[model samples]
Target: MRAIWKGAVSFGLVSVPVKLYSATENKDISFRQVHAKDGGRIKYQRVCSLDGEEVAYADIAKGYETEDGEMVILDDSDMADLPATSSREISVEKFVPSEQIDPMLFEKSYYLEPEKVGAKPYALLRKALEESDRMALVTVSLRNRMSLAVLRVREDVIVMQTMMWPDEIRNPDFGAVDVEDAKPAEVKMANMLVETLAGDFDPDEFEDDYREAVEALVKAKIEGGEIKAAPTPAKTGGEVVDLLAALQRSVDAAKTARGESSAEEPVQTSSPSKGTPRKTAKKTATGASAAPRATKKASVKKAPAKTAKKTAKKAS
Candidate 1:
């Protein structure tokens, strides 16, 4: 893949030339809006609110709305005059353990590949990070916006992940949970249920069932098949009157579904039945068994053979 950005990794006086490339992809089906009668594509135009006419791209300008609906327009030169502290260089500030960073702070990830003769330094940095068990905290700017980022070893290569600002997160302010004063027995049962359902994380075991069903429905529609919506399964009624009994029933159901019981499940094998003719096995006088040979049947002649026989008798 082509690199999206080319820049140097700067820390102290050291600078390593590197290139950044996207690491992920989206695989979603897309549709377009069209005129239903004519099947023509629809188009949109940008019009000014005051004049009610289509506006040209050159006539547009960036503006900020302030108090009292006042507008403050910013020209290209005005934006260019902003601080250039985070313009070109990735300035490393400090190093911290990778686990110390919260997953919510990450915004986007890009693969960093060393350019030209920078391989030694890149490998050195990767090895150093692997040894230190830490990630380098750095800042970089793109599209006139500076963002905090983390640089760390992803296997043998380095990756840079942009982070969001702290203030971007909203505080959780639920007034109060109505069921805060839950009964002791309910809490105990809930804990027991949680313990029973707890399992190791396995991403492969999970599936997008809704997406699969939707795709299947699309395929059926494309094939001109009659579509009938399936009814949603009704949930089991009523709360558990006996928590221990419900838990035991769930555990028993799971075990049965997994076929984990020790009673020796029936082995399934395919073999020719007694009704089907089989090759005869040979047994020698010395009790040594010999491999069986396959038998072949003779083909019967039809009306042509009878005609040939009549012609032969007439000739005789």
Candidate 2:
């Protein structure tokens, strides 16, 4: 597992240099938009709504649509002036009881591996958090943005999980979901039902039935000699020749379209081999009190033709 970000964890006068690796991934199978009659991928162009003409990638600039319906176009210089931090220190703000943290705030999880010289201090910090039964609230800069995260010990390893700002969590307005309480007999029966089903959670016991079924169906189709060969997507005028260059252009174009290059949440880094996230450590620490919800995972935005085709479809 290659390190995506290199930084140091600092608390009081102690500093532990560590490498950060994403601790989670998405396994959802993806499909693409295509011509059903033929094996060709559908493509899209960046056309202006008003002019109705395709726009060049170089001509694109970030635009912010105000609440009053005004478009505030911003150039590269404008975006450059926006406040961004790239600090390499994971500064600990305070140690708080683990239970105090709301699981809803967790956005992403990462593992921290100590540098050779900082091994002792890293273990000390992990042991301290475990002994105190607390989590170290920290501020770290990742991808040129400062974020709130927590450092806690999970199975003798220190894990850093980024958090969302309070305002980002919308308050539910269900208009008082209050209802009458159940009768004593009904409540007793409900408790009995709960006791009947109660058991320790072993993650291995559960499986992604939907994903497994899809895989099996695809395998059966392949065995039956059913397949379509998607033609290579044709490149437009002045397209980048190199794959890496094209990918970088797609990333930059996506950032420009969003009007916000700053990632609110940390995203996974590509692995050295198959592009999937990898772990070199013996095991991962995912049994922390504030386990990140699968729904909140974030991915780095990319906009290649194939990816854009997939993006146009409703997510699985």
| lDDT of the candidates, in the order given | 0.63, 0.71
Tens digits of per-residue lDDT for model 1, 241-313: 1232233334433454556562221122344455633221111111111110000000112123453344334
Per-residue lDDT of candidate 2, residues 99-209 (tens digit): 999999999999999999999999999999989999999999988999999998887889999999989999988787754676889988999999999999999999999
Best by lDDT: 2
Model 2 lDDT, full chain set: 0.71
Go through the candidates in order and give the C-alpha RMSD of each one to the true structure.
29.4, 17.0
- Model 2 TM-score on a 0 to 1 scale: 0.73
Q: Name every residue pair that clashes in candidate 2.
A: none
Q: TM-score of the candidate numbered 1?
A: 0.61
